[model samples]
Target: MGLQTQLRRAIAVYRFVALGYPVLLGALAFDALQRPVAAAALVALLIGWTAAVSYRYTRNGYEPKVVYTDLAVTAAAVALSAWALAVSDRAWPISLGPWLAGIVLVWGAAWGRRSGAVAGGVIAVFGMVFRGGINENTVNEAALLVLTGFTMGHLVRLGVEAEERTRRATERDAAARERERLARDIHDSVLQVLALVQRRGNEIGGEAAELGRLAGRQEEALRALISSEAYRHPLDGRRDLRELIGRHAGESVTVAAPATPVRLPTATAQEVAAAVASAVDNVREHCPDGTRVWLLVEDDGEAVTVSVRDDGPGIAPGRLAAAAAEGRLGVAQSIEGRVRELGGTVQVVSGPGQGTEIEMRVPRPREGDADGDAHRGR
Candidate 1:
């Protein structure tokens, strides 16, 4: 248990013992006033014993041994009260109050609700037997005491469960936020560097060219992994797709979009942008110098689509799928894999002689879909 919980338990034990002090003093004074020397001595001894038990409880930090000590003290108090009742002529109903209160304190600490109820039941039975009859006042008081202990114990348990749930929720939220932040950093920095290497490979002839091509392919695979739903950033804020694409468009690259906004899910938008960027990189590497690339963004009612077409040598039959299998999978893995994850389809209408037309279609997410909520919340 936590230090705070231990301290609270200690405080509860001390409070119960302290509450007995006034009752003990009152019992002794009543016995003495009635000229019952033996009864007064018994009450005095009970007070001293309770005080010693309380002291030991404080010293031991309210350990399990305190429960044994409490039982012993309660037994002595009950026996003394029974003896006093036998000797006293004046019906001393109030004399049983201290012993009953001690039972409440002991059972409340030891076994909680069930034992407290049992203790209360025992006290009620004793009251009826000793007094020789049950009265309205006795029943009402007994019911109130038992209910009070039960309510207190139930509330304590509820508070503990609520606190634990809150702690777990806070931890999960923190972890998600951290993952989102890391995703943003990777997308902005490392992905950009890899794209640059891929584009510059054509300019640097020979072995350096081959190295550049290899780096470019690796970059595409990395982008594919990042665009997957598993790596999507949760904190992706509202972004203008046209503006993001325009920012990356160079002199040779041409970006075309509708005059109106093409709002897309955060994950979809990021993947589309990444795919467009990769397509442009391929044109820069394979096509003749200064080849023009066109990017078109179309927003249909039910879905959003992006088309990246190039006036360059198109992909050969089975080449895209074969490249993906051989780990040379840039377009297939990054662009196609990303669209598929979003419950969308990627169509590559390309062949030798005819220019390549890469179209990506992502359907709108439904109300309660996990991916939809994830992008919307971001």
Candidate 2:
């Protein structure tokens, strides 16, 4: 059941339990009552109100008018207690007693902490005015009433906010996952067909070459549109690391990823992916023709690892440092820069004729934590 419904039911239950306290109080003071018949009538009225409130709550009576009437009746009953019983200066109201707190709870649950506190104060003030004076006992009772209203209402509000957050997060995850599925479908069908058309059109010259150029532009636009990370909450949604890496697979490149999605936040996934792309680009620029590349994605509970390997002439020992010293910073600025910004590490394993393998290791971002907080451990 929803939080509000459960709170209403709890109020109903409290009404039934609290009703007995006043009944016993009324019976004990019946002989001493100045107007015994009226006191008995008020007691019966309380019983009927409790039963009706319980039944209405069960039937989903969430109307504000019920709470209003309840507040009015409770206040009225407290006022009448002084007239019905001769013991007017007694510590508690003869007609209401603990039963009055139930109406305070209803106000708190239906409205919020402030409204509940107001309801409690209103009841206590009405009781004090009717009973002629506010003593230590009456003040204590007022404090208790206000405390009950504020605490219950505050707790209910907290639960409602928590539920809303959970619901929104669930919807966002679902949307991102569905979009990932659609992207794969488009890549497998529409993207491949467009690529084929562009290649064939270019092979046949003249007007066909111009058509091929147009086709290529359209294909790029469609691909970018489908893969755009322009979300309203851009950094919030999760994207599959697999989908980003899988797009690089071709005749000379092989991609391997977990059977299930290796999901990460949109920004983190995109950054990691851009880092991978940079590595592959570096390979293509320097390596010989027909050099093979492999991309591997691993999700090992605590962290995500993406590895790019190439069977090409390897970087000579200290060559990257020499290149960096000469201001040729392709590896440092693009690959290492992107990964380090995401609190990840990059290791380049290469020597002459050993080929090159670059590994990027990043701890999974902790849910509901800031980037700095993720570094602080979950």
Choose the strongest candidate by lDDT.
Answer: 2
RMSD (Cα, Å) for all candidates, in order, is 12.0, 12.1
Give per-residue CA lDDT, model 1, range 12-68, as digits (tens): 565556546535554555644444565566656766766676666545644666665
Worst 10 residues of 1 by lDDT: 369-378
Error of 2 at 103 (Å): 2.2
Off by over 4 Å in 2: 27-36, 53-64, 85-95, 226-228, 231-378
Which residue ranges in model 1 land beyond 4 Å of their true spot?
Answer: 1-72, 84-89, 96-112, 123-138, 184-378
- Error of model 2, residue 238, in angstroms: 14
TM, every model: 0.44, 0.56
What Cα-based lDDT does every candidate model obtain? 0.62, 0.80
Best-fitting candidate, scored by TM-score? 2
Please estimate how well model 1 matches the true structure, expressed as its whole-model Cα lDDT. 0.62
Q: After superposition, how far is residue 1 of candidate 1 from its true place, in Å?
A: 9.7
Report the lDDT of model 1 for residue 292. 71
* Pairs in steric clash, model 1: none
